[model samples]
Target: MAHRFQYTVISILSAVLQKCGLRCTRKFGKMLGLLLMLQTKRRMITYDNISKAYPGHSDEWKGALVRGAYVNLGITFAEMLYSKALSADDLINQVTFSGLDVVAERARNGLPSILLSGHFGNWEYLAMAAGVCLHKPLTIVVHPQHNAYLDAELNTIRTRFGNIVVPMHKAARTLVRTIQEGGIVAFLADQHASADHDPQIEFFGRPTPTYSAPAALALKFNVPMFLGTAVRHDTGKYSVNVQPVPSADLSDNPESVIELTHRHVAMLESEIRANPHLWSWQHRRWRM
Candidate 1:
């Protein structure tokens, strides 16, 4: 009974937000961002995380990044409402792609590739763009939120562009099947992982827990791996960059996969360094 009531509330809220998003203007969007910055605890945590990550920065600088992050998030949410309503030409005009040939080359060889990225710069749109550009559905692995109603709504929106979202719990089998069928599987590997599920690795100069499943899968399937990231430009547009993972000759030993994974993470660290504000600073990514 409680679940049903919650679902009803979520459905109503989703409809209301979608309507508002469709009608939102630049001025009103900025105002909404201000309101969210003032009221959201998550935003506050994001500020705190930024401070910890860059202790040399002044309070003013940290404050600005926090506000900017919320504004960026708000814009991303609003744009998602218009995702289905917009055409590929419209979206393409807003986002530019780089290193696309890497994806193309791998796909041409009939080899399944693992595309790894993080939660930065409208990551959702990156998957959608890949689905359109690669001409192959990109399977994204995600964990459902506790609220079933909201989760269902988000899943529907995410998969609208022909990409598939697989639940993280069943990701192994789904990934294996996708690879065997010569499909691309994309996922973020920077989140904090449960002790039993993820092994500890050095991240951002600190010992952090990260998911090794991607590495394990790549090794088991003998598939090539790629790195992709999107960055928010000053004009509020986004650019996605993809690159082939550094070569590793692991024919004789399987443990080389772990080293290759760490190397990829190191590359991601350089990206995060280039634009620290684009990252999800609030995540307790380094926590044990």
Candidate 2:
């Protein structure tokens, strides 16, 4: 009953967002972002994150970035709500692709790859748009939302355009199989991986815990890897950049895993630094 009610609320929000269309949804979602910014605790988490990353910045600047981060998140959610109503053409038309030659070459040679991105921009579309663009689907690893009903509802959008979804915990076998089959697999490497056993990487100049599985797996399988992100423009249009991560030359070993992890994490950090607003700052990503 609780899960059903939660989903009902999301459905209501989705309806409103869908009706607004892309441009208007950006406007509407910012309004929602303003409201979300009022939540003191989470807002501070966002603010603190910004401050830690940019210690020299003035309070006003950090505040504005924090606000923009929430607004970015709001817009991401608004855009996602519209996914259910989008056909393949609608999805493809709204997003432009860049730096895709690497993926194209891999496809031509029947090779598998590890696609990685952070929580920046419309990361969902990063994996979604690649399929029809290349005529090959991707296996995407996802974190399961606690709300089982909402999880299914959200994943429905993910799979609608010919992608396979695997929850993080049970994804090991599927990931191995996909690589062996010469299929692409995607993972978001920005989320917190806080287990004591988890390896730490330098993120934003701090020793931050990160998900290293993507790097480890890529090294283990000796697969080519790429990092990509979807940048949502003010007009609500998006441009995706899929750049090669230069992993093929690395020998598959423990040291290689760490090096690959650092490389991808640095790429994401640079993206966030370039556009702080596009990345989510709400997570307790860094320890004080």
Candidate 3:
């Protein structure tokens, strides 16, 4: 009964989003974000996080950033909903890709690579577009959504353009199989992991719990890792940037895991730093 209700809601939302199209939906999302910041107290979390990261900035500077972040969050939410209704025509015009041949080259040379990225820009679109952009099937490791029905729907959209999704629990086995078979694997590596056991890495001038799976996998497989990001442009479009993480000197070892992990985190931080407004800052990433 609950699943039926969820499906009904999703169908109605998808229809409305499809009608509104990407551009207008994004405008709606921006407005939604503004309303959220103005009406809700969650803006406090945004302000606090910004202060910690950019302590030297004045309150006005920080507030402007926070507004941008909230607007980004709203735009992202709308985009994700519209993803379900996205057509190839809509995707092609809305997002553009660069540096894909670099990673795709690995497969041509019998090398399987790990793609690392963060929650910057339209991350969901980044993965979704990479499916078609790379000209090859991408194996994405994602955390499962609590709602089984919703999770199924997400995978449907994710795989619509020739990509695969594997849940976190099954990621180890699936990634190994894919890598051994000379396939590409992607990971969203920017989120804060459980601090209880996860190693803390320096990010944005502070030690933060970071996921090391991608680093470990890259080292163990002795394959190259590519750091990618889908950045938003003033034209209301997205541009994907993919480049290799400089780690040719590192061998498969515990030390390499830490070093590679830091390198990827730093890469993500650089992107977030370059475009501070494109990132979601209200999630309270800095526990300190």
Candidate 4:
């Protein structure tokens, strides 16, 4: 009953938001950020985490990043609201892609590859752009919100360009089947996970729980794994860089999966270091 009510409220809110213009979306995000900053414990945790990660930075510098993170989050939400209205040409003009050959090589071999990325820089746009560039629909694993109406609406927008959005609950089976059937699967690996689901891995010099599903699937199917990141440039444009993960023959044991996962996370860490402001710092990524 509570879930149903939540869904109804979200549906109405989404409808209202959709009708509102871009200005309204931006305002909504700002209002949300203000509320989160004022009431959420997560805000302080995020600020402290950023400070700890960059010890040498001044307090003012760290505060700027925190504010930027919230602003980016607002932009992300606004983008999500109108992502379907965006066209391939618009995305192409806004986003630059590097390492096409890496994706092309995998596609040429008739073996599907697992593309792993994090929640950075309007991730929805990145998936849509991938579908456009690859000329094939990319299957994304997503954890839908509890609100059913909002979830459905959001999924509709996400799959507007024909990319499939699979629910996380059935992701493993769906991913394996997609790979076996020669379909590309993309994973967003930076989300916080339960300790049991994802063991602690070093991220930003701290032990953060990270998902290993991408590594496990890549190794199990002997498919290539690629590291991709979408970074927001100063002019409100995005650049996506895809790199091939180090080849690992994973015939040995399950522990090999953990090592491969760490390598991918390490690569992501390097990218984050290069531009800490673009990364999602609002997440309570580390427990302590």
Candidate 5:
């Protein structure tokens, strides 16, 4: 009964938000962000993250960035809920791509790739747009939501546009077979990993835990890899930049995984630095 109630409430909210259209929804979402900024504990965590990631900045600058981060997140949430109404061609038209030739070439030659990105910007669109652009289904590794009803509802939005969603624990075999069959797979490399999970990497000059599956998988399969992000512009349209993952060497050497992972981390860090507001800072991403 509770699950049904939750699903009903979320469905109603999504419908109401989409009726306002993208621009109005984002405006209202930004107002919602202001409310989030008032939460003391989360505000402090966000402040500390910004302070450490960027030192020597005044409190005012950090405050604006933190506030903007929340607003960005609100907009992201609104856009994601509104995405259910978008058609495949509508999704494709919303994004302008850079380095699409890489995806195009890989798709044409029947070569699989690991498409990686952080939590910055509209990361969901990155996966969806890639499927449309490459004309192949993409398997995205996703952490399961604890609530089964919400999980099913959210996963429907994710897979609605010709993409496959794999729960993280069950992703290994599915990812391998999908790539072997000449398909693309995507992963979020910026999420936190426990020290034991083999996610040692440097982010924003701080030693932090990060998911290394992207590098490990790419190296293991000898597949091509690309890092991409969908950045929202002032007009609310997104421009996606997909580039080859720059790395030293991708041999099976143990150090190669660390190096490749750092390369992906560095790329994401650069993007976040360029637009700190577009990235989420509310989480406890860094340890004091």
Candidate 6:
């Protein structure tokens, strides 16, 4: 009965979102974000996170950044809902690749790779763009939504353009096998991991718990790893920038797990610093 209600709400939302189209829906999302920014709970979380990350910034700066963060997420949400209307080419054309040659060369040699990114930009679109470029489906590690109806709907959209979604809880062995079979695996490594399993890593000069699975897998399977970002442009298009993870970082020595993980976190931090507004700052990133 609860699932039915959830499905009904999503059905109505889908109908309304489709009618709004991409551009208009994004505009509406931006406006909605502005309204959401006024809500105390999320507003405070965003402000606190920004203050911690940018210590010297004024309240005005923090507020503007918080609003921008909300707007970015709103745009992303709108684009995602409207994406079902887009064909593969439409999705592929939305992003320009800066380091395709590197990825292509690696792919040509049948080398499996682990691609890492954060919560910046439209991460789902990033996966879609890579799927188009790689000429094969890429398996992505994702946290399953608690709402069964919503999860199924989201999974359909995510996989519509030839990508596989692997639930995070049971992905360790599957990810290893996927890479071993010369397949691509992607991870959003910025999210906070469980306290018990997470490795401490530095982000913006503060210690935070981060998922170490990607680093551990890269070392264990000796697979190449790359860190990349999908940067949104003023034209509403996006460009993907990918950089290879240095081999030295993923040293076979067990001690290197934390080191490799730090490098990934650092890469994301650098990107976030460059475009502070592009990230989701409302999420509690640090316990400190």
Worst 10 residues of 4 by lDDT: 247-256
Q: Please give the lDDT score at residue 102 for candidate 5.
A: 81
Q: Model 1, 28-72: lDDT tens per residue?
A: 455666677776677767876777677898999989888776776
lDDT of 5 by residue, 134-164 (tens): 8888899998987799899888988887899
Write one digit per residue (lDDT tens) for candidate 2, span 31-60.
888889889999988888888899999999
Candidate 2 similarity to native, TM-score: 0.95
Prediction 6 global C-alpha lDDT: 0.84
* lDDT accuracy of residue 78 in candidate 5: 78
Every model: Cα RMSD to truth: 2.9, 1.5, 2.0, 2.9, 1.7, 1.6
lDDT of 6 at 84: 82
Model 3, TM vs. native:
0.92
Note the clash tally of each candidate: 0, 0, 0, 0, 0, 0
The residue-by-residue lDDT of candidate 4 on 75-162, one tens digit each, is 7776676565567887667677898567766676766988888878778888888887777889999988877767888889888878
Q: What's each prediction's TM-score? A: 0.86, 0.95, 0.92, 0.87, 0.95, 0.95
Which residue pairs show backbone clashes in model 5?
A: none
Instruction: Between candidates 4 and 6, name the one with more favorable lDDT.
Output: 6
- Clash list (residue pairs), candidate 4: none
> How far out, in Å, is residue 177 in model 1?
1.2
Off by over 4 Å in 1: 1-29, 39-41, 250-254
- Per-residue error (Å), model 1, residue 169: 0.4
State which candidate, 2 or 4, has the greater lDDT. Answer: 2
Q: TM-score of predicted model 1?
A: 0.86
Off by over 4 Å in 3: 1-7, 38-41
Question: lDDT by residue for model 3 over 1-288, one digit each (tens)?
Answer: 897799789778777987888788888888988988985658888888889899999999999999999888888877887886677767867788778787777777877888888878888788878767666788998888878888888788788888899987788999999999999999988766878767799988889988788888888888789888888887778998787898998989889899999988888889899999988888757674
Each model's lDDT comes to 0.75, 0.84, 0.84, 0.80, 0.83, 0.84
